[model samples]
Target chain A: MSDSIPDVKKVGALLLEIGGLLMSSGASSERIRITTNRIAEAFGYSCDLLITHRALMISVNSNNSNEFFSSLKRTSPHGVNFTVVSGISKMSWKIVEENWSIELIKEEMARLKSISAYPRWLTLVLVGLAGSAFCFLFGGAGLEMAVTFTATVAGLYVRQESHKLKFNPYLNVFFGSVTASMISGLLSKFDWGTNPETAFATSVLFLIPGVPLINSFTDLMDGNIMNGVIRGFNGLMIALAIALGMLVSLMIYQM
Target chain B: MEDAVLILEKGFWFAAAAIGFAALFNVPRRVLWVVGLLGALGGITKTLLITQHQSVIVASLAGSILIGILSVIAAHGKHAPPLIFSIPAVIPMVPGAYMYRMMLGFINLTATLNSENYAQLLYDTLHNALNAVFILMALALGVSAPMLVTRKESVKNLKLKRN
Candidate 1:
């Protein structure tokens, strides 16, 4: 019976290690929050920690917190591997184990992983396009504006997500505006099948509220001032981009 | 008469499209209808408010402030996305089409022989564009006023948190 107990313990530890690896690999901002929250609640512990490379490092400020440490040990396995990344040691498995749990932590993390899913980007695109189409129909634009506005905004939104770039707030605003200006200018020069107003509206649709103006306002209202300022700057850049595009088109017309 | 109605209908649908787009994006549905009404009203009233010989800036300011006041009441009531719900209504007042018209008119008049007579038309166009810009700025300021005032204390509070 004594011999069998050690073997059972080893196997259980192995399973927990593998699960932690999988959860950390899929970490997103929301998942990270839930994972950390679960760990704190499960162990009756509260600590500030960062998870990196599929491992968690928790900071505890009490001497008798060793009991809490053992709980983490049961939850986390892989025996607390440590590395000097982010100019901080004691920030990986070593901090968790030499300090906290291995098993319970893993179980809570698995829950977070189960709940995590990517946002549905396509649904947002269809919604925006539908709005643009409606605008084209009612606003004094011909068929040309509705079709183009829908296509452009949808395409921009889709392409942006696919790239997975650290979204530069100003770039999209400027680019969307410039692109709209170009299309509008081309349509105006040709005096095409539809009126100029339709063409202008269609091109500018993509440049609209996708910039998060209202959300920024809400953030400000909620007293998240920095976030509000950041989003506001982003919105301003977008408007400037539109103005730049208009300026360029004006210059071209003058020439 | 029929032509005018058709134009109005098209404008109505365009406004509806914007409202529909807002809905699809999960903007509060109650607010969307109000935004549509405000947009259409802004468009129609703007045309009526334009007198042949008037101060363009004054006209735009009055219109923008008027719309801004209405938007705040509606937005606060619905607890909707303020700028998203209000900005579109201002779209109908955007001077894009009018500015284009002015530029085109300038080009056509200049290209024609009666250059001196075309000055009045060119001046009118410039006035309209300037008025549009002024109005747009006012609209932006006015619509954002409620949020800005509410945010001041919150912003100050955030500074304390960051430190």
Candidate 2:
């Protein structure tokens, strides 16, 4: 281990980088605070972090001296990537155990950032299958599951395309639901399945904002009420967007 | 015997759904199967409890707590955090049907404020909304309780050992 402490400014920047990554990647507030603090402690410094929906502020103080540094970094828009969250957790442990230098930490962070998501086609198809599973679990028969599979795939495609076009996240959800429900609403119109309503309902199950809802509750439980409320409100807004989309489709089908 | 078979089938679909969502969330490939297993366990537990005539809220709570405990244990073996497994696993239990009904009734209520069935619509909407909210809270609290109890001490120990 290096006898001298790392420069406080660099450490503060690194800590802010870690905090921003975790915050944007759907981590609970507690996890962000803990993971960054763990990395800072490993470098013989103490970290205090103030996390909000829009930005992260971190202060790092050297244990050996009066040196201190603090900085703020604006987080990017939120997204879900469990791989990044877990990767950083593992990296923090390695930093403490292997005594990773800041350079090595930077390299590992770059590697993590570059990790590719699953292929777009694969994700869409599998998510479609998941929607079918939900339909079946909800008592939909084979034909209903098949219809749900189609609707979910189409809806997710629209969501992905809109997301790529830099549309608002909630707008993307609204578009996805509109597409999915419109497709399934046709099943009800044609009277093809034993329970067409089940298919219609479960088809949009793919867009339920599961991460934010779960994370909001965890944040609240950990006493981070401000972040918890923000996340909860975010989840509720996405859900409302979904409902409005479904309502439009329902009106079209006149159901 | 038939009931057991039905539960197994439900569990299978639940596992499949969980794995698909896990992939969408970009869960690490190494632990995808673990997520599937945890999902199946939670779903089967809820199904079994419901068969025994338990309320949906209680059953959901039991299932999510099981997932939470198992995820903590699984994290040790896989070298990943519990949330990666628990979040995707608990997702299959979301009260989608209730939420859908609530939203549908809400829309109808707004459109028919003076209709004869307005009171019925209002009651149904409130009922479904409350059920959905409670079940969601149960799932979240159950999955997070174990981690909240264990994480602080674990991190503290790591820091102490190093110092």
Candidate 3:
């Protein structure tokens, strides 16, 4: 496989696909660069990737000839799927060691993309539990945790439903936060918990943009400042949306 | 004895939170428990440091450093990217409450510009926002420090050795 050079166009498309998958799946910029470079090296080509928050570009040149190819892909909306990231990473290594063909890489990419996420109900329940845990960690009592749990589950459900309907990402966060805070606020109005404020504060914890916030910093540290700033700004906007939602709920409760 | 029990309890909640977030991120099932264990250890480390009178930001940095190192090792053994473990594990330390408060403060500041408490609101908002920002920076820096230092050798080498 190393002796025979693959088509530059095919290699370019493959590298772009790989880069696009990694980008949308929440891989850090450094990981995307390294993984694509590794695969290109395995195929006896030199590859360059320019990754951004919403798109990826790849340029490939052959070692044995003047063949050159460059292509760009607009990535799908960002989502966190560590399973895809890990699978692609492992596949890159396998491509190097096993000398997999371009068709094989495409097949593997399809398989990895098709891998099912955890069941919706399970994710809802567990994420709700996570919110309650945050309540406890923040010094909430049992009743507060219970309230936080209910609020979080409802919030996550609403968020998921809106996402399925293709709602704007910030609007989805606003909706989820409002739902969670409203639940906790109404419960607090009824005086059902020892510390209703804690429930109110922690119920929206599930909506925190952990991945983007962390990735932004990593990207900045790696000198991918453009992507870093975009991600960081995106995270901040989502956080503001969550806060606005909570403020709306608070005003409604006061009324 | 009481302190030990408190730390254990905290660790349990942290583990549950980490596992939940990890699942939400769709980390593979086989490594969910590994993420949980790492989350517990990292949370416990932070809690212990806080108990020792360290600031929250310092404790977070220390805990995240531990997570970074451990996740690198785990990534090798499990053949997964280190972020799979580190992101979820570090979630327990994210200052969600502070972030919320800061945002709330800003909202209130805007709505109460003529009020006497405006200065207090501005101060509190800045305080909370800065705290959140620094802790987040600490976490990112701490978690990436190991990988940054080992960049020359590369995580690829680590995986290669495992094979």
Give Cα-based local distance difference scores for all models. 0.46, 0.90, 0.89
Cα lDDT, model 1, residue B132: 50
TM-scores of chain B alone in all candidate structures, in the order given = 0.54, 0.92, 0.93
DockQ for every model, please. 0.10, 0.75, 0.75
lDDT of 3 at A141: 92
**lDDT (10s digit) by residue, model 2, range A18-130:** 88988888888988998998899999999999999879988888888999997889999988988889999999999999999899999998888878568888888889989
Colliding pairs, model 2: none
Candidate 2 residues lying further than 4 Å off, grouped into runs, are B149-163
Model 1 local distance difference test score: 0.46
Instruction: Give lDDT: candidate 3, residue B31.
Output: 93
Residue range with the least summed lDDT across 10 consecutive positions in model 3 chain B: B153-162
- Tens-digit lDDT track of model 2 for B1-163: 9988999999999998998899889998889899999999999999999989999999999999999988877877777888999999999999999999998887787777688888888888999999999999999999997867766534334232224
- Tell how far residue B128 is off in model 2, in angstroms: 0.9
Work out the TM-score per prediction: 0.46, 0.96, 0.96
Over B1-163, each residue of candidate 3 has an lDDT whose tens digit, in order, gives 9989999999999999999899889999899999999999999999999989999999999999999999999988888999999999999889877886887787787777678888888899999999999999999888888888887434657544537
Candidate 1 Cα misplacement greater than 4 A, ranges: A1-141, A154-164, A178-191, A194-202, A208-236, A243-255, B1-14, B17-26, B51-63, B72-84, B97-129, B141-163
Ranking by TM-score: 2, 3, 1
- How do the residues A142-162 of candidate 3 rate in per-residue lDDT, one tens digit apiece? 989988899999999999999
Candidate 3 ranges with C-alpha deviation above 4 Å: B159-163
Q: What is the C-alpha lDDT profile of model 1 across A147-255, one tens digit per residue?
A: 4555455445543553356445455455555555565556556766556546654455545533245435544555556645655665566656555555566567653
